[model samples]
Each structure stands twice: as structure tokens, then as C-alpha cells.
Target chain A: MMTRRIIYLDNAATTFPKPEGVIRAVEECMRYRGGNPGRSSHSVSVAAAQTVYSARAAIASMCGAEPERVAFTLNATYALNLAIKGLVRPYSHVVISNIEHNSVLRPVSSLSSMKTDYSLFDVVGKAQGDTEGVLASLKSALRGNTGAVVVCHRSNTLPVEAPLEAIGELCRKKGLTFIVDASQSFGCVETDIEKCGISALCAPFHKGLYGPQGGGFAAFGKSVSDREIRTIMQGGSGSASSEVSMPGYLPERLEAGTVPTPAIAGALAGAEFVKRQGASRIDRYERELVEYMKKRLSRFDKVKVYFPERSCGGILLFNAEGFSGEELAAALDKRGICVRSGLHCSPLSHRVNNTLSCGAVRASVSAFNSYSDVDAFADSLSAVLSLR
Target chain B: MKKCYVSMSTMTLAQKARNILALNKIKANVVKLTVDQSYGGCSWGVETDCDDQEKIRRILDISDIPGYRFIRGKE
Candidate 1:
């Protein structure tokens, strides 16, 4: 008899087995519309430009933004770099959360030396003690020079949800730019840019969006003045070729050089698939599955589960007694269970949770996960914990 | 089978809701009655009249908690 294949639960890193439509879209783009977008006057080039614009429109609709305000980037990291480095000026103040991914943390940390004062607030416990606490913390951290407030919708480890609407209201009141990093929570959670008052939002296509690895996009809010947010890169934007400078527009101004048309096309398919399925239904299903897993894990005396009161998505972080996180992860891997065990790029969160040394085992679920998969994981975990 | 009602104050925010649902298994709906409003937390009411009372009681016993008031709904 043949053994079963490994069960994938590390979706927080990247989604696998691209949805059929996503693959088909990429293949179609490569085969037929292989011209440079916004480059030439030829029909193929125009078709390519139309495909890219359609993708931009889909992403914008999903995030509740206008099509023209959306611009594609290499990935969330690059988009974040462009947002932070381009927006904050010398002596400007910025507000951030302690649960941000390295994409936001590292970039902001690097900018610390430019005489820009930054206040990193802990969202664990502030006024209401739930995600609402994070919003209050962000509001309190704002100062007179507060040029922008950057926040991660969900944490890599804790999975604590951020109150984007409340924070957005405060930023609007203060006339400050509000940037959101939706890397882990974009597709799984609903984001209404208009309601949240978000000035800019950076998201990767690979994770919750279920797109190819290389493509990502940023949605710029209408309230954000063009002069307030500068472009980090300058070069070919498919237009304005006569002059060497970048175009004085929204997307083209930031999207310099050749666009990843194939990746964007694939992401468009993924976004469409997600839209068809409905993000709210997906969210509810994942929440129920996570609750089931949490219940099962709680039965064992040795298992230590870490879940926030309010979750952003389906990522679960935990460890068992008498066994290191790495040891358990390796043991599970031997049993054909895929999980991630490490700092997860947010060192500050690990240090705060005291899981920096061995780190915590992360089992993130996706829309593809089934009830049987959760059962298998729970049984495998029980067996692994009993080994010691 | 007699109904088993679990109080909200007895279990942790997540545990209280989950335990009642698992025990009832079928034909039961967990209701949030009154709860500690801190951190958006609240209480729930579970309907367990459709299942076996002894089985439900055993399951609830294993799922230990504090400050709970169990009630039997009219059968």
C-alpha cells in the first residue's frame, strides 16, 4: 500500500497548488498576450496593457479602492519599502505596532537614523484589550510630526486583529497618512479602504490572495496628496518616454520599469476566484476550523496553545511541554505534516512572547483545508507529544 | 433526555462556547446569554434537550470550569 502525502499547513509563508484559474490565466498571458504592457502602439501591447489594467481593477475592487490608485510591485516587501521610504521625511514622526512583519519593521527601523522619531506601540493590552486596544495605542502614539501611521492587519504569531476603521478615523482627523500592511490578512479578511480611511495599503499576492509569488500591489487612497507621498524608483513607466523623468501620475509614478504582467494576470485570476467564493464565507469557515483545532489541542495537558481573543485569520501558534518547538516540528515533518518553526521574521513578537529561543510551531490553515485534515493534524500532534 | 444548560462564567471565553456545542452534538444551539463584557466577551446559552443527559453531563464534567450554573430546560 502507498503512504499518504504530506499535509500542508504553512500557508502563512505562501499558498500552494495554485487554483486552476490562476494557472490558466498565467499560461494564457504567456502564450497570447506576451507584449510589454503600455509600451508599444501594437495590438498585442494594447491587449497586454488591458490585461494588467483588468488585474489592477480586480485588486482595487477587492480592497474597496479605485482602479487608477492601484499600482503593482514586485512583492509586499518592495511595496512597503516604497511606502515608508518615500513618504516619511527627515524629522518626521511615524507610528507602528510591535506585531509588524519584517517588511514593515525592518524598513521603519532602518529609517530610524534619519532623525525621524518612531513610536512602536504594543497592541496586546490598551483600553479595550482586544483588537480595539491596538487602535487606541496607535492613536495615543501620534505626535505633532506624525507623518504616517503604519499597521499590520494581522500578526504573524499572535494573529491579533487590528482595528483599522478606528485607526483610520483618527488618522483622518489628524490629517496623517494611514498605511496598512495586509500581507497575511488581505484575501481572508475584508478591507474597505473608504470606511477605514486608509491612505495606502500594501499586500502580497502569494499568501492569502493565493496568487503567484512575485507579484503584489498597493492601493493609494484619494485623500493622500501626490506631493505628500513620493516615488522611490524612477524609470520607464510605459509612457512619458520622451522625458527621462517618471510620470506625474498615480500608478505610473510609482510603478517604474517593466511590470510583471504574467504574475499580475495570475493574481487577477486568484482575486476573481476569491471574490466568487466570498471572503466572509471563507473567513467563517476558517474560524470554525481554527476553533475546532484549538478545542482538540486544549484537551492535552502537555500542549500549550497561543491564540488571541480576536483573530485576524487562521494561523495558530503553539508548543508542547517537555519538547522544543523545533523538535515537535521536525517530528511532525517526519510524520508527513508540514509546519513552520522559527522566529517567523517578527523578532520583537517572539522576544515579547518569550519564544525567541526555540520559537513556536505555526500551523496556518487555508481555504483548502478540510475537516479530515484537522483531525489528522490533531491525532499526529497527540502522538508526537506522547513520544516524550 | 433532559436539557443541560451551562453558565457563561464557568469557562474561558472560547472553552465555554465550544464545550456546550460538542456535548450536545446534534439538535443543539449555543446561545450567548450574559457575559463579562471585558474585551468584548459575553455569556452563552446552550440547548441540550435533544441528546442524552448522562452523556452530556460526562462531557461537561471533563471540560472543567469555575462559576457555572447548569439548568434543565422543560422537556
Candidate 2:
């Protein structure tokens, strides 16, 4: 009996069929160590806390962060919100990339409505071989009151990446905080906190780290002062109870309320998986798939691929002539190819790629995806194009 | 400065207490407890010098870590 595997190309949204040992760790945490971390010093509680700490350490080690400074959030959105709202004060100016995801835009927009001013730097220029042009755009966007600069490591709408290290250097020279939304690039790319001058690196454990959903982390660097990065949400931190005010610490300062222990447990195993597999190996495997997918699928006249120059992550953005992104994706779906169509919660990315009218189709692969899976996608795309 | 043990309900809180003490200039080491010292399979605690025990106790009180009772000591 042969059972066919569903060709999932939506790793950008979330990694499906999570890597091995992740499920077992989640189940084990819920069943065996069912105690509240930091609430007390009971054996079960301490054990649970150890598991969470180990996960944090694993994630931080990979991100080039100190374990104690990494704070767990409900998801990357929460982490991003914490970073954005925590940094921007009233009347502060900020700079952001033009092709940011909604996670970055929505929170920054909230600040805009309040009083903070912001300017968007052109990142599409970097993708078009204008590296110095991108740097100039970022420099031009900065103002005297610019307190922070936010950028996405890679665009979700395209396979293109922003000049993060350059932006980090700019932030350092300007003495402004640099925040990176690493949702689409963390596990597949290296984000050294110090080298990149990242004040806070926000990402979900699921997408690239191959961890569970509902778990996100933000690793804060030394650039974020305890006084500057204030708390947005405050409750029982389980660390400092004697004072009415929240405790002034790295993780405990940011984290308040009960954490998602089960998710953290799963993330522990997932981080272990990433560590064992190594980020470079995963990047190499995904790059191979992306290369194969691009070469095989682009020969069709109807297919117009964007960011084909990318050799980093496993993401392909394209449009089929005479067919809308939604329609093309639907046809692919019928062929057991799971892909994301439309804005992908990132309207600005479409605007940057000149896909404002009809959103582009995204087929993002994971390390687990093989060459055969990509071949299936290409074959299905060709068959669908011929039908049209 | 006699070395002693201060056990909390959870390793997370114990580690926190140790960090706080260090920040306040009180010396302490966080370590996994020996099997004989544990009723359960595994246990961890802060090892502080007796000279700083009162200081650590005062700091812990100020921390207000919930349900924080000294599980064991006097080893």
C-alpha cells in the first residue's frame, strides 16, 4: 500500500508535519511535568521550568543571544509588538523598510496614529542590484529624532532580502535601536545579535525553527537598555512579588503571566532538531529545492518568476499570465500542492514588488521538502498553465 | 562563611533568586542537588555562604516570588 504525501509549499506561513521528536516532547510536557513554572519550587514545577529554560537557551544560542534575555511570547506578533511598543516613546521618530509584513506595519502604524513619526526605506532597490541605493534610502529616511530602525530579514512576498547588516551598521552609527522581524529567515539564515546590532530579534518557533505553533520568542541584546525598553503588559512575573511595580530584569521584565509551557517543551525539541541539523545544512537543502523549482517551472511561457536570483531561502514568488494568483493557487491546490495566494498578510510586500493589483503566488519550501516535491509542483504548474 | 542550601519550590525561582543575590553583591551558586538530598528524582537549589544567608533571605522576601517556601537546608 503506497500512501502519497501532500506537497506542502506553505512553510512561510507555518511548517507542516513538524520535525521528529517535537510532538513527543509536547505530549511529554503536558502529561508528566504539569506544573506552573516559577510559581513555586516543587519538583514538577522546577522540572517544567528547566525544560523551558533549556529551550530558551537553545534558541538564543542559535540567534547569538544570551539565554536569560530571551523572552517567550504567544507568537511572533506578540514579540514584535513588545519590541515596537516598548521602544517608541511619544514624539520619537522611526525608520522601517518599505516591504515590511503586516506584523511590522500594523504595530508601527499604531505608533504613527498616536504621535510617533516614521519613514519607509526602499528595500526593493537592494533586490534590484542597488545595494548602495538601499543604504542611501535608509540614511535619507533617518531623522534627528529617529529612535529605532525596524526591518524584516526577508520579504514574505518575494524571495528577496533587505540589507540587514548594512542597516544594523547604520543604526549603530546613529545610536538608534535596530529591531529585526526574523519570521521568514531565522532558521534558514544566521542572525548574530552583536554583529547585526539587533536590539530585539522577533520570530516564531514554527516557521523556520520547526517548532510548535503558538510559541514565539524575542531575544533582546545589550543595545536595549532596561530603562529604554519598558514593559507593555504587566502581571505576575513569578520573579518579583514584594514590589507593586514590575521587576527590572531581562526576561522577567518583559514576560508577565503564565507561559505556554507545552509549546515551549515542543520548541525545546525543535531547537534541538535545528541544532542537530545545523542552519547551514537546512539552508543548503532549501536552496537546492528553490533552484530546481525555479529552473523547471520558469520554462513555461505563462510563468513569470520574480527574485529568481535568490539562493538563500526556499521561497518562489511568481505569477501565471492570464490567470489571477488566487486562481492559479486553486489549480495547484487541486493537484495536492499547498501554497499561499493573495496578500499573504503583507500588503506592503506586494506594493514593493509592484504586485499591488493582483497578489503574487508564493510557494515556500521547507528543509523536509525534497526535489521530487518541487518537481511535482512544477509539473502541476505546467499542466495547469496548458489548461488555461 | 559556612556554605548552606536554600531550596525553593521550583528551579526557575531558585535561579532567579541566585541572580538577584549576585546583582546585589551577595555571592551564591546555583547547583543540582545530590540524590540523597532529594525526595524526588531530581532537585536544584542555591548554595549561598552562611554569612549571606540573612541577606539572601531578605532579598528573596523583597522579590515576592509566589509560593516561595524554603523546602530544605542545614546540610
- Name the best candidate (by TM-score): 2
Model 2: residues with Cα > 4 Å off, grouped in runs: A1-4, A126-130, B1-45, B48-75
Over 4 Å off in model 1, which ranges?
A: A1-4, A126-132, A308-311, B1-75
Tell me model 1's lDDT, rounded to 2 decimals.
0.76
Q: Write model 1 residue lDDT over B22-45, tens digit each, in one string.
A: 545644444434323211233334
Assess the local accuracy of residue A100 in candidate 1 as a C-alpha lDDT between 0 and 100. 77
Residue lDDT tens for model 2, A98-125: 8899899989989977689788988778
Model 1 steric clash total: 3
For residues A165-246, write the lDDT of model 1, one tens digit per residue.
8888988998887889999888888898988999889999888788999989888887875556678888866443455656
lDDT of 2: 0.82
Comparing only chain B with the true structure, the TM-scores of all models are 0.47, 0.73
Q: Residue by residue across B1-75, what tens digits does model 2's lDDT show?
A: 467777542355567667678889987666555555543333446887777767777888887644343434564
